[model samples]
Target: MISATTILTFIGMATATYCSRILGYLLLANRVLSPRARAVMDVAPGCVLISVIAPHFVSSRPEEIAALAITLLAASRLSMFPTVVIAMTSLGVLKSVFN
Candidate 1:
C-alpha cells in the first residue's frame, strides 16, 4: 500500500515539473532568441536527461554499469528513438541475466 506521504510527494514533484516546463515557454513566448540561445535550447533536454541518469554511473551493480555503457554507445551512434529502444532492451536483458 502507498502511504499518504508518498502520494503527496509524487503530486508535488509532478506539479513542480509541470510548472517549470510551462514557465520556460511563458517566459520565452514573445522573445526572439539568438542562434546561440537556440542551440542551448536544443541541447537542454539532453542535458536534463544526463543529469537524471548520471547517478547510475556510480552504481555498484555490474549489469547497471554495463547498461549505462551500452546506452552511451547507442546514444553516440544512433538516433533518439533507436537509442531509447536499445537502452531499454539492453537494460531489461542485463537485469534478467544478472539477477
Candidate 2:
C-alpha cells in the first residue's frame, strides 16, 4: 500500500504538469516567436534530449560509452533512422560481447 505522502506527491506533480502545459498554450496562442526565439526553440529539443540522456551516459559502462561515441559520429554523417539503427546495433553487439 502507498503512503499518504506518496499519493499526495503524485497528485501534486500531476497538477503541476497540467497547469504548466495549459499556461504555456494560453500564453503562446496566436503568437509568433521572434527569429532569435525561434532559433532557440529549434535548438531546445536537442538540448533537452542531451540533458535527459547525459545522466544515463555518465553512469554507463565503457562499452556503452564507446557505443555513444560511435552513435554520435554516425549521427553527424547520417540521417536519423540510420543513426538510430547503427546505435542500436552497436549497443547490442557491445553489450553481448562485453557482458
Best by lDDT: 1
lDDT (10s digit) by residue, model 2, range 11-67:
554455445456656777778988997576445434533543365478559777888
**Cα TM-score of candidate 2:** 0.52
What is the C-alpha lDDT profile of model 1 across 1-99, one tens digit per residue? Answer: 335674565355445445555676788889999999878765654565466558889999998899899989998998655765576667678877987
lDDT of 1 at 38: 72
Clashes of each: 0, 0
Backbone clashes (count) for model 2: 0
Poorest lDDT segment (10 consecutive residues) of candidate 1: 9-18
Q: Once superposed on the true structure, which residue ranges of model 1 sit more than 4 Å away at CA?
A: 1-31
Q: Which residue segments of model 2 deviate by more than 4 Å?
A: 1-31, 56-60, 79-81
